[model samples]
Target chain A: MSEIIVNAVSKTWGGVGGVDRISFKAEAGTLLVLLGPSGCGKSTTLRLIAGLEEVDSGTITIGGRDVTHLSPAERRISMVFQSYALFPHLNVAENIIFGLKVRGVGRAERDEKLRKVADIVGLSHLLERKPSQLSGGQRQRVALGRAIIAEAAVCLMDEPLSNLDAKLRHEMRTEIRALQQRLGMTMVYVTHDQSEAMTMADRVILMRDGHIEQNGAPHELYNEPASDFAARFIGTPPMNIISWQDGAMLGVRPEHIFVAERNGVPATVRAVEYLGADSIILCDVKGETVSVRQTGYCSLPAGTQVGLEWQNRHIHLFDRDSGKRLADRAPA
Target chain B: MVAAVMTAAEPKTARHRNWATNVNAWLLLLPAIVLLGMFTHYPILATLYHSFFSLGRSGPAEFVGLENYRYMLDDDVFWQVLRNNFIFALATVPTSIGLALLMAVWVDKKIVGRSFLRLAFFTPTVLPMIAVANIWLFFYTPDYGLLDQFLKSLGFAGHNWLGDPSTVMTCLAVMVVWKEAGFFMIFYLAALQSIPPELKEAASVEGASRWYFFRRVTFPLLMPTTLFISINALINSFKLVDQLVIMTKGGPNNASSLLLYYIYEVAFNFWDTTYAATLTVTLITILAAVALTKFVYLDRRIHYQ
Candidate 1:
């Protein structure tokens, strides 16, 4: 519904650091997740887009309207805060329709929209309850309901799933993604959890130290990460890294560094992690360590001599100093 | 059963911490208990004992029954003073709390030199009330005070602030607000600061205008704090009487006298012991009511995460 454009948008907190020289654009109705570790300025960038924060320089445009100088209420957008920030004093129904009420929406239309949003967020029965009376998941749905009732072209979510427990987080993410797609509203979600971003976002803008390390589709960011930071950041057990001579860092997914019998390199098993499905083998070779995931929890013992080799196609090469992906110029 | 018995016995070993922890626990509680006994328990016993009889200098007091209470109901000055006390509480409590909230919100905004503004709001509270009365006395002077000087500049003569019956109560109200607003502002400021910034930001994102944000969000959120502060202000409004001595002397018609000042007059000025004790009971009753209301409404609403 809205195309968000950041033209040389930079937010500097004068001295220390914030999102600096950040410039990107999201096409209409697409979900763009700004993924990074905590304090990496992703949240600040989202706030800037929502007009909750003032940028130090440059312009932001949504649906071809410049909004750099506008306040958040004037932006015709809604934000789901990390804490949800539902008005505790207001009951669930009132919380949902608070935005419409403020805009002088007629009571009938407000009630209609409230019913629609509450139904959409599955909060129909809980409308009479205060936010304090609801469970964590229900509060989040109320927060989402508030956003949806606004019917703004763009919705900014700042780590909204972070407060929920893991199982509920997974469920909410699916529900949120489904809702976003069904409504076709532009969403910019900020999260430190790569899995959340990977599962929810159409495109992930991976950030580090106030800079965009890579921006691409989740699979693109995963399967062909543009930098070592992206390579190490995307995978769960994390990308196992080995520093070769002349400072090239060999990066590969844990599963890719599996136990192999075909022309394998010399190594000794350091420790074996017995996960139910697969066991991860931590190995040592020439005073360096690398983790390898083997299929099925094998009874691999410590001090076992092992050979380590990976699929040539799956190995990721990262530059020595720059840490940029050596995709095209990787060593043979 | 054996595991349960072992688990139950495990805590017995922990409870036997060799006198050191027992002594530490007692040490921590000792000061509070002793102070509570000395200040809280003894006073109640004494007040109850003293309430039944009249205390006379150098004599065992006689039980006066309901004579003191009966006398209080009929005393003209006591009725007038009681009326004046209510007027003082009414004028000061609501006005001070309202103005303090206004000042707190304004100062809490991103104003330039906000600390200086806060200091200005709180300056009178830090000053001794006697000194503040001295300051207001000079300002209230009919001929040469600041009010008269300003009025004279405008081609008008300011009436007697402390002397005029019509304006004396208002003057007292202004003085009390000046002396109390900043103190109340501290409570309001704490409550304001404790409100999560995201609450207002979320309201903004919800397209709530400033008034809607305040009425629906901020004020409702501040209700418990407001009630608490109002109760405190009410009790203090009835008790503090320094300005009465300096500026009014409970005149120019006993207009500005408070319950405490009236009690002071009865006990010390008129040399009436039993009746003063009766008024003291009245004062304690009102104070207790205010305290009870505060506890009932406020202490129950501790903000939860």
Candidate 2:
């Protein structure tokens, strides 16, 4: 019952640069991601839930307890910051058990917990090393160890993997997901990287301009975006959004479209991007740029004339003026 | 034969270039070396050399060879001033440092009129020591002084602050602390600013109270700055002589005098140049020992980022 319910939380500095009345719920034992670009107030929302920022209005609850006015510690939550914030002077072991010591836990219990957490984070051998001596990854582990050793029911992360390199980011992403599940902690992870949200989150809350643009499971957001913004924000190549007839926009995923010989929309092959597993053929339909994903190598040259087609079920229509998804399906 | 000769010439040219680089480096170092040797090294050596000699007030000076040292050991005024100097340091250093840290932490917060408060705290540091001493001297002046007048309003009797031996050292120490704490606060403020805000936020999230966070994290991280400020403060305690000259002048009975002021008195007023040189040598030895202990011991124990 460590579920967190953020009800209409709003925080702003002089009516600017903070979350609008954002509301969401993170169920117990589930990883919910708040995904957005910079300045979208994703971090602000997490900080609000963590009680680091006082909301201008509305209440936040943890496990049915209204913690809106409680301090960060009083909320009974742990957090991993983007910078990791390992104390430079304290060694790994001391850092892991710092919170326990702060709570006046016994020395023997602290040591036992330290050993277990050190092993879990794979920092047992490096316990005596100061943070300055550790590599970037190891320092991140120290921060993680510090956060998890508290055994708090709820944990919040603020773009924790943004500091790591690509390979390490991937590694930590999987490791963090596994650890979160193992501990059964209700976690709200914030990240600007949609791939991270898609890969690690049980539910993703996509934000825009301090408000939620869309909220759903990853596949739902990908397959059925609520608006044009959500369509272009997910997936690697993202969904192709082009102007359609009569004040509407047609949406199609890059993978859903295929090259057709005839009886389809007329387009020209603009370029080809060959990824290892698949090739993306860039095509110009009328005036809009559309990319069609093709398996294996795409031998189409830049100036080749081509026709693009997709199944009726793959096409999405949105009203041009509002950018909201149209309920009706397009003519097949 | 030509190839062999080409290889043979290379080492010689390389050696010549190396010699030129050495000379260039020395040329670059010339100005600083010249100034330090002329003003600092030469005076120290000259002081040490003169400490063993007689004043020769009546005739040519002669070698005294530790006579001034023996006389210093027996002089009551020397002992009194030395004791006063130590008492002055012990009283001023920690109090000023603590006050500076407190002021720095206060101003570091995002409070209303913060810049104004910082400027107010720093105003004392910008004043000349002579001006500061004169200002404090007026405050400590007997019945007509601001302190006594205020105390009188509180129904307390007027007391001589500087004229009395018992109160003079304490008065001077209070003035020095007031003048010096703001300058030290600048250093602590800078150190506090350099610490990442994330550390405090992290500690807060961990259920650590503000006091606990400061005690364990902020204070430990500030060790390097503390060590630096402490050493500077200690040396400053010994080096300060300007305020004493203006305020106490070694007092009615040499009660508030420091070693440097005593040396000044021996050298210029009494015309005891050799004994003054002896005192200067002792002062230099003490300062050197303090610096050496910091470098050899404290620096190793403290964490520097």
Candidate that scores best on lDDT: 2
Off by over 4 Å in 1: A245-247, A327-331, B1-65, B296-305
Interface RMSD score of candidate 2: 0.7
lDDT by residue for model 2 over A1-332, one digit each (tens)?
A: 99999999889999899988888999999999999889999999999998889999999999999999999989989999999988889998998898899899999999999999999999999999999999889988998999999899999999999988999999999999999999999999999999999999999999999999999999999999999999999988999999888999999999999898886899999999999789999999888899999999989889888888889888899989989999856774
Predicted candidate 1 versus true structure: per-residue lDDT over B50-154, tens digit per residue: 666876666978887887788788988888888888988888899889899999999989989999999989998899999999999999898899989999999
True-contact fraction per candidate equals 0.83, 0.86
What are the clash counts of all predictions, listed in order?
1, 0
- How would you class the docking of model 1? medium
TM-score against truth, every candidate: 0.90, 0.97
